[model samples]
Target: MDANEQETDREIVPERLFQSDSNTCASVCGAEQTIRKDFLDMLRERHDIERHTRWYDIKKKFESDPRYRIVDSLYREEYFEDYLHIMKEEKRKERELREQRERERHRERKADRRDRDKDKEKDKDKEKSRKDRGRSRSRDKDRERKSSKEKEKPKEEKGKSEKIKKRETPEEGEHREESDKEERAGSVDSEVARQRENEAEQKQKEREKKLRAEQSIREREKEVQRTLAGHLRDRDKEREHHMREECIGHFTALLTDLVRTPDFTWKEVKRQLRKDHRWELIETLDREDRERKFNEHIDNLMKKKRERFREMLDEISTLQLTSTWKEIRKLIKEDPRYLKYNSDKGEREFRDYIKDKTMTAKTSLRELLQECKFITHKSSDLIKENPNHLKEIQDILKNDKRYLVLDHMEDERNTIVLGFLEELNKRGPPPPPTASESTRRNK
Candidate 1:
């Protein structure tokens, strides 16, 4: 029984240990998750992490915060990297969606324009066909009128001959009959000549009218042709512009991370780009334009690099408003960002950083003083009334973190406060509302 109890105790002891271990692990994981959540929240609230932001920069920027320090370094870096990737993917999707929308809108507008042009062409053709049909009807009517007149004229001539025959006596001489026949023949010839003259006049009028109609139609066609030519020219210009922009975009895209650096020369970059199929896209661009764009790209790359270097300097824990480049350089000499510029340039940038830092500190301190309920527009008068009031105000400001940032510059801080007081005094207090103004506002 003792041996059996000993074995059972051993088993129970191991089981308890296993349970305790599992609980500890669960608690640790829960705490880690909570810390990670807090850190991410802080990042979301304060930091605008972009694609270009580096891990080193983020670490230096947030290392002082409690939330950032709670998470393990490896986990923090992993989370940050994952967040950056997610953000970049989201931005890329958004950009693609916008471009797709723009392209769809362009296609819709183009289709609408084509439909309108087709409708206009159909309307013009309909109007032209209607005018042609009307002209044909008018021509048919004129022909019928002329034919009826010709038929009636012959009938009248026949009737006149019959009447003359009725007037003739049987005993008339042959010479008289011959003379009458000659007169009849002359009259018939004159009448036929008059009919021919009228027909010639009518033909001349129709020809002139036809020529005028043809001239108007030709003028309209020529105008339409000119308008079409103009539209074609404008369309070609727009197409060329779009092509040029697309080519430039393709050329810019060809500049990968390897070639997009301040260190890369235009000649070297051009050689590398020529090997790529995208080079053909910029064939329409001149050598000068290509070189110019290359130079601009380099300039932008250098500018971004310089800005990142400045941000690194801003985040350096060892850096101070009073720190010199010589001291600061020693601390950052091992950093890769430090090697980007020579000593002289780095010194100049450090000086600028210090100057900007001092200004920011001063501004923050001033704001703190302004926020104090003790300080007012009439602070100057109060100080004059009781010199202890100024000391009290200074004591109140010294407790704030912002005031400590510029505590070394006592005179500057005092000057800022005095200047603010002066400004407030000059502005003066707002006037009280009159009876009329109050009544109007109530209404």
Candidate 2:
């Protein structure tokens, strides 16, 4: 049993130790390879833990083997890497959004600050104005008080009661005296009121009389103003009538020109026509007519005048009036002053008579020329046989005092030539015109 057996045991133990070392190294290599393979799978798979995990099994596995720590650690590392990157991007976006919101809030605050400052400035100005108004109002009140005080005066007379008041008197005595004074004051006040009533009655009567006088004066003034206004209006109407007469004269001249030359402006013709014939006082007054029959009478007179004048112009055109002029001259030669004079006047009257006839002939001749163009051409033939008649016709055209008659010849019924003759017959023979017929014709 001894040394050889101990050496054999030692050799066997060395062999066993070598074999165990080899086996342990092989197991460690296999475990490391398995762990590496699992790490690669975890990386590739990127496992989800939040939704798919069963809590009980996971707890059991952790409690049973604690090797779940390795898988969990691996999973957490991958999970944290991707999740942390996403969280960082979300944080950056949130920061940008918050910055934008902050910028908007800052602008709103600035605008609100400006508005508040403006309102505050306005309020400050208003407060300053109100304070100034208060000071000015106080000054005005003081001035009014001073003016009132200055206007009050002290009385000069002192009564018996005032004299008595300066002496010391008993209270009962003072009361009895005061009652007596009050009774006396009441009696005096009644007397004063009676006097005032009498005075007021007299004053009222005077005032009433004065008011009646003033009313009468005002009525007289109103009557005068109304009469004056009527007179002034009548004067204005007379002036307008004169102006219309002048314008009508111009219109008649233009019409005569237009008849001579047809190329005249109708616009001017219409304007002159409207100015001359568009208005009449009767038509204007017709609106306010209180007497219909009077208005009708005036209207009838005007209508007759217009109708007669128009009819006569039509007759002159139709009758070829030049033949009558020839007959009138022959009759005038037979009896020189038969229709012209009474011989009571001198040659001056005879000249006036010839001038009047010549004027009538000129106006009648113009009407003949305008209305009877064919007759005027035929009348020219009479000049060859009757040289005297031609001389008279030339006198009527050039040196006759006919322009004056032309003024009134516009209305045959209202011709001034006939009106003057009627008026002259009513008066007697008048003096002839001093100027020559040529000067009268020029006028």
Candidate 3:
């Protein structure tokens, strides 16, 4: 090969190698992030890791866990903090969503009530209009009858006068009688027509009134049925709630401390529970529900034992927060609470108790800083602009008993104070005045 071709080939090889290396680095980074996420998810599943949990406590608890080894030890603490932040955010969102749904339901119910009231008013107005029309029709029928009666009286008077004249003149009387007969025939036809029209109108009014009555009856029946169904649903829910509570109470009574050991099996507990008469109270519950309640009772017992052990630790005045598990094991080995678990388990609990205390101390110190009136949104910038401002704020905080909790951890205290000031600054200015308030101010 020529020297120029050889050099070109060498250059191409290095470019390919560089591209492959970049791809490999990208893949490695992606895999690392995936495992790190899995480790955080594992920590979330651990019910023992509470809001008060510390990195030291969690590390010892899950050091041997497969998922824990996925992430490097350096990143575990950072991931745990992320997990805590995610939980807090999720809880806040859930609370806000629940409140918003409640408000919407309240508004919907109010609107439904207003619509019902409006419908009732409209129905009352229609009924009143129908009654008024009926009254006016009856008045017109009375006036017609009065006018017909007056016209009949005038015809009768004319007939009397004509009869008297007929006795005097026979030919004239015959002619007058013929004309009266024609007039009477026409009056009879008119009266019959008026009677038929009145009958038809009365029948139409009666049919309409009957139809209205039937419709009202049907509507009432529907309303009654809806109310009855709602009552039945509420009753059923109440009964279910009461029965669930009774079942839980029965389980709590049956599962005593002696029966709910770490090695306790569901089979043995079921056999023992069935023999007792109190089991009848919870017999209606499904098998899965019964087992779940049984497991919950056992967990409660374990939690109470852990609390009692922590209480024992708190009562010991000689032990320091920084004491090692080996040192703590020697101090509480003879205690009954300590003996409740194995040596390793007891050490884990001691570590958790110490972390809990540290978390509580840090929380107290933060609260003290928040309550300090001298601290403001601009406090962080002010401290930077004037160094002595930091000391002055610290001296003010020193007077409070809560500040003494983290008095030895100067760096942590300063970090918390600065972090809080930064948070306040991030909040920006207060909200604008509401429209109603603005209107009131103008007035």
TM-score of each: 0.52, 0.20, 0.42
Model 3 spans > 4 angstroms off = 1-187, 257-268, 286-292, 315-317, 358-443
Candidate that scores best on lDDT: 3
What are the lDDT scores of the predictions, listed in order? 0.82, 0.54, 0.83
Model 3 lDDT tens row, 283-375: 887788878877887787788888889899988887765678887778888998888899778878888888888888889888887777777
Off by over 4 Å in 2: 1-191, 261-443
Best by TM-score: 1
Is 1 or 2 the stronger prediction by lDDT?
A: 1
State which candidate, 1 or 2, has the greater TM-score: 1
Give model 2 RMSD, 1 decimal.
43.2
Q: Write the per-residue lDDT of candidate 1 for residues 1-443, one digit (tens) a residue.
A: 69999999999999999999999999988987888778777777755577866676457778789988877777888888777887788899999999999999999999999999999999999999999999999999999999999999889977976786688765554566788799999999999999999999999999999999999999999999999999999999998897778667767767753474688788777778888765776899778867877888888888888888888887788777767777888888988787887888888878877888898898887778768876767888888899898888888887898887776778987888878878877877645579658877889
Candidate 1 has which clashing residue pairs, if any?
Answer: none
Badly placed stretches (over 4 Å) of model 1 are 1-201, 264-281, 431-443
Comparing 2 with 3 on TM-score, the higher-scoring candidate is: 3
